[model samples]
Target: MTAWETERVAWAYLSRVTQGPSRVVSDFVERYGVVEAVRAIKSGVVPRVVAERVSARAHIDTAAADLDAVAALGGRLVIPTDDEWPAWRLVGFQTGEFGGRADTSVPLALWVIGGRSLLDVTERAVAVVGTRAATAYGEHVAGEISGDMAVDGWTVVSGGAFGIDGVAHRAAMGVGGVTVAVLACGVDRAYPAGHARLLQQITSSGLVVSEYALGTTPAKHRFLARNRLVAAFGEGVVVVEAGWRSGARNTASWARSLGRPVVAVPGPVTSASSAGCHRMIRESEARLVSNARDVVEEIGSALSGDDEQDHLFSRGDDRITGPAILVLDALPGSGSLGPHEISELSGVPMSDVRAALVMLEMESLVVRDDTGWARAQRRR
Candidate 1:
């Protein structure tokens, strides 16, 4: 068969619901030409070669009807040649590390949905992932980092699951920023049905993506495999919270292997939720980030260290002297303080305090949650 026909057959085979059998067929096609591979599968001669690799079954016929159905489900079956396919995928797939197996298991096609194209969104993206049973602190930090990245014109990417992943997606959406959910399941059937609405919002504002085809269910192992794509697509990976064997840490490992920067959030010393993060820091696998600015500064420094020195969070040309600056310094990290309280704490006049508060609020430098104003976005 021609190369085009071979690729189409490979894609079609990979899109089937059956996993091992389809992979065997696809691998055979990938190794040899499609005509010979199809003949081997049909003649049952291919099973012995892959008998130790996967449980084989009869060759499944490719169907136009199934391909059409995938399209009808708002899914785009994208090949490497597609205009919207990420150029990075070519580079990523060629690496063959971290379960990527570019030689054997590179995705034949990806199913995509949502507003931003995969290629466009991945250009300025970061992955924020962690344990599904993350602590409250983990979720909070993920939201802050993801939200800030979104506002800074970077897409926040994560798997659309519970805990840190969900928090990141919600916070980005709250700020009218783009967030993409990279799923292990098909985009048509957003797994963890609880995130259905959140996934819809994401699709409207950004995208929901997966390597699986339409009507596929999420598998435990698939998510571990999915982390590779999250790492492959992002410039960096941030682990907000993780345990000894958390999947987020898996992504971090993959990111490091791929030569991307990794960042980890520091939490309470006693909390098991943060043990993995601390370990990462100790092992020199990632940098510690207390707030969004720390992350931005790191990324900016990598791009151009000079740009980082240009801005120093100063109120003026001097080190520090503005009411807003003083107010921010005085506010508590976890809770809000009213204008009167802030005025008292900063020792600034009430009127100046009020004006600074307003200005800060307008710039989203501070937020008022029922009681009073406090730092909104994390300090740079």
Candidate 2:
């Protein structure tokens, strides 16, 4: 093997031996570099924390074989040393770690497939995610938002599972827009199996990426680990329909931890599936987003993080539209109502209600809190 190939093999070894979010090992690799770190780990000379994480698998070296396996499938191992390593997108994992999120450790390497360049597509990506046991409303909403985002030149990203993730991927493809799937399993094996064809379609068009080795199968813990990547890659996350304790909620937390804007779609209050999204909105961290336009607005503000406040509230100066006025009047003076309640009270659909809320919030006519939406100090 060439020297570069040898370096990649070392990365493969380190990446395969342990489950990630191993901040100690990540730091060791940072301090000593991949080549030397791999040597020390193998020779049992690494730190106690690193050894505890890797000792079980350290003796088994499948780096060469795994590299060959991915290559045989027409994919490649993308290491940090490579130019297309997604450094810009994944950079937040560093700060994410310091911010006390255990799941935010930078990956040692990745296995990627498909024709599209990973870096190019992730530049403006949004993760559309929710429950596997999704409702028709959830699927419908996911499709509309994903398709619209695609048409607007944003890459739609998801976990490649059933329900919302699958809907998001297919919707993006239906519009011939870029989409990416960050898998918990090996890129070679479709974990849901039903989406084997969907995974293949993604390979033919966008990318299917994983940090695991070529044969890694999906598992409970791995899926949790995978959510961080979905959040990290996307500039924002939009939860369509999530149960109270679903992976979509986990992804939302990761997004919030990464300082990415998180948007939640409120559903019918009676929907058990939408419990998580509603709760997230109630927590006041996630923006209420009902459609693609709302998602773009939230993500646009996030991207322009350094720009003037005027940039985000550019439309704030405009006279409040009819919808905004109606939404304003729907609010109970002292208490709060959620988007759905406001929709019902104002005789407006939740999508329009969300837009009006955005305008109202910017204009200081309304505010949102853990309880939901209420009147602000003054109406603009």
Window of ten residues with lowest summed lDDT in model 1: 305-314
- Best candidate, lDDT: 2
Candidate 1: clashing residue pairs, number = 0
For each predicted model, how many residue pairs clash, with residues at least 3 apart or on different chains?
0, 0
Candidate 2 lDDT tens digits, 141-174: 9999999999999899999999999999999999
Candidate 1, 149: how far from true, in Å?
0.3
Could you estimate the TM-score for every candidate?
0.69, 0.79
Residue 8 alpha-carbon offset, candidate 2, angstroms: 0.7
Cα RMSD for predicted model 1: 19.1
| lDDT by residue (tens digit), candidate 1, 1-380 | 66764555555554553341235545566566555655555566765745433234345554345456666766556655455666443243333344534222445567777656777787678888888888988988898888888888888889998999999989888899888888888678857888888898888888888777666678877776688778867777889988867888888886766656789998998999898999999899889988778887765554332221122122222222255655665677678988888877655678978887777677666788888776675445
| Alpha carbon deviation, residue 266, candidate 1 (Å) | 0.5
Clashing residue pairs for model 2: none
